[model samples]
Target: MQTEKVIEHIVGWLKDYATNAGVNGFVIGISGGIDSAVTSTLCAKTGLDLLCIEMPIHQAASHVTRAQEHISFLKSNFSNVTDIRVDLTPVFEEFKTEVSLDGNQATVDMALANTRARLRMTTLYYYAGLKGLLVAGTGNKVEDFGVGFYTKYGDGGVDLSPIADLMKSEVYELGQFLNVPNSIMKAAPSDGLFGDSRSDEDQIGASYPELEWAMKVIEEGKTISDFEGRKREVLKIYNRYNNSNKHKMDPIPICEIPSDLK
Candidate 1:
């Protein structure tokens, strides 16, 4: 589909979903990444009131700067866009300390990182409830489904995901079509959870482009080795994440009654 058509479809979908659900507006947590930037822009285009939130929890200075920049862009460009920056450092620290006392320690950096994602999720929901808005998610197809790169019940918790079917590469295309700020478009993708700055590729063991390629290849039931050399490494990383994160990607399980019992 053309980029313009994709934008039109997403905008229409958001409007229809909000009207059907009788929600007041769209609420989104902007992370200064291309995906969030695109999603927020799409929501803003729907002409409904939009709340663009910037939630920083022990975030890197660069990430915070980018987020603020995006917020500024939104406020300047969109009349219906309202935004605020909420710092969750104190809340996160208290939660971490309290959980540790209960034998649920945050010893591992990854554990603490996920805690940050969940905290942001909670903050988003809190505002969504107040404003009668639906929480718009920023996840794309590759991260949300192919590798399940999002934090389950954390960033994964959302009322709706507008771009969940778009690949990371496809998201970039939309970003360009939407005229997202070059700072965000050129910046490396990061979850902005950990204190130290690390791109998603650094944590995911493969770049978005590499993973996207691997996912497409595997989806076709073709061997990864068909592409020569280090490309094979993409297959290994892709398979590892695809298999391990199935739990995050799959729907919640429920107990099923036996046929006779039913």
Candidate 2:
């Protein structure tokens, strides 16, 4: 579908989902990335009461600035858009001091990074509960499912995901169609969990466009033997990330028995 139609459909779906689910509004954590920018714009288009929150825990200044800018844009275009900033640094620091871990520094750093996401998740849901709103998620297809890059119960925990099916490339396209600020649309995507502000590509080892192509190849049941050169490299990277993160994407395993007794 065209970007215009996709935007309209997503808007309509948001409206219908809220109406059916009896939610009064949506609460979304704005990370200053294209996905969040597009998701917030779509939620605003639904005409429901919405809260665009910037929960910064030692977040990058550039990211916070872009988030506030996008929030301002949303407020100007949509009166129902309510914006707020929550600082979770103190909470994170306290938690960090309280917890103890054994392993390499990398492991500890990763755990702390994920803690930031979970802290924001808690903040979003806290407000959502108070306002009777659903927590809207911003993850796109590539990050959410293709490589399972989101932290489970952190960025992955949401009542509704409006764009989990869109590829990262598609998200950029929709952001442009929505007239999102060029700064955010062109900004490197990141989870904002790392204090040093590494781009998602830096963390993932492959860019979104490359990841998207590799996702297609894998989903089609193609083997690495089917390609050579750059294609093989892409497949290798995809498999490395996707295979290790499978636990993040799959549903919880449950023990079940047949009802043959009946």
**Candidate lDDT values, in order:** 0.90, 0.91
What lDDT is obtained when candidate 2 is compared to the true structure?
A: 0.91
Lowest lDDT 10-residue stretch of candidate 1:
99-108
TM-score, candidate number 2: 0.96
lDDT of 1 by residue, 126-147 (tens): 9999999999999999999899
Q: Every model's Cα RMSD, please?
A: 2.0, 1.5
Task: Quote the lDDT for 197 in model 1.
Answer: 77
Clashes of each: 0, 0
Query: What is the Å distance of residue 112 in model 2 from its true position?
Result: 0.6
* Superposition-based RMSD of candidate 1 using all C-alpha atoms, in angstroms: 2.0
Error of 1 at 215 (Å): 0.8
lDDT of 2 by residue, 100-124 (tens): 9778999998999888999999999
Query: Which model scores highest in lDDT?
Result: 2
